[model samples]
Target: MASEKTDKSRLRRDLLRTRAALPEGDVPVNGHALARHALQLPELTGAHTVAAYVSVGREPSTREVLEGLRERGVRVLLPVLLPDDDLDWAAYEGRDHLVPAGRGLLEPDGPRLGPEAVLAADAVLLPGLAVDRRGLRLGRGGGSYDRVLERLTRAGSRAALVVLLYDGEVLAQVPAEPHDRAVHAVVTPSGTTRFPAL
Candidate 1:
């Protein structure tokens, strides 16, 4: 398992590096296109309440997408990462409500909800370094998302788990561990692709 994890980590890093080398305008454009496609998905379109992450560093920014959702009357929940790597939830009012969170990430300024609130979300938009056809995801190694996803699954929500990525970042396979949280779909600039069951 350790070896597998190491391999996955290396693969994820390589993909991230490649993506980073791409032009900045291209990255955001691709991300926006992907977000547009993802919004068309039934699970996403039908969702009244959605949970999304604030983009930081090289992660694709969801500011425009979130704003569009807000215009459509969708309730957005943004993740607040705690010191212990646990996630708290806060309602997204708009760009004005965002404040700098840990690790240079932006989060909503408001009361936070516990794990149960996350479970009630109609869909979740996740960030990742890379994802495979089997739905296994390679995150930033913090394990924060993995922990939260485990709690959501255990709660029987089965919320649509979608990871946003550049087209080249989606891989045919990725190393996986038993504890890794598998996503249900991947959204790229090209389109939204559903992954096979893990």
Candidate 2:
């Protein structure tokens, strides 16, 4: 168990370093490609409300994906970080509605809807450093998304859970704890990969 934790720590450090080295192109090209790939997902195509987050740093930018979803009339819900690191949600009106928030994050400036607001979403997009072929995700050492997934499970949510990653971020394996949940699919700039077979 300890060895797995150490391995996860090592992998996270290595992956984050690689991400930091990426060029700041506003990630326009990759962002738009990620958005385009997302459109091909049956889960996304069927979803009306999608719980998502804004990308900061070199993390696969959700900029184009968010804008595209909004343009297509999808009800976009963005997260607001709480003091405890759990997320509260709000409606995404547009880029102008996002304002600087703590942790160098941009959050929705709209009314605060409780955390359960994600329950109404037909899909949920998650952030990750990497994902294993089995769909286990390596997050940024924060348990926020873990809590969100727990809440979704307790609520029996049918919302499709997804992760947007860069091509190389998909790996053969990643550390996983018993409490960890597997994501349903991963959308990369190249294309989409599903887990547990649809």
Q: Which candidate is the best by lDDT?
A: 2
How far residue 151's Cα lies from its native spot in candidate 1, in Å, is 0.4
How would you encode candidate 2's per-residue C-alpha lDDT over 85-176 as one tens digit per residue?
99999999999999999999999989999999999999999999998899989999888999999999999888898999999999999998
lDDT of 1 by residue, 27-119 (tens): 577767877887788877899989998776667767767887888899999998888898889999999999997679899998888756788
Residue 29 deviation, candidate 1, in Å?
1.4
RMSD per candidate (Å) reads: 1.4, 1.4
Model 1: lowest-lDDT 10 consecutive positions: 56-65
Q: List the residue pairs that clash in candidate 2.
A: none
lDDT of 1 at 32: 79
**lDDT for model 1, on a 0 to 1 scale?**
0.82
Residue 60, candidate 2: Cα error in Å is: 0.3
Best by TM-score: 2
Determine which window of 10 residues in candidate 2 has minimal summed lDDT.
22-31
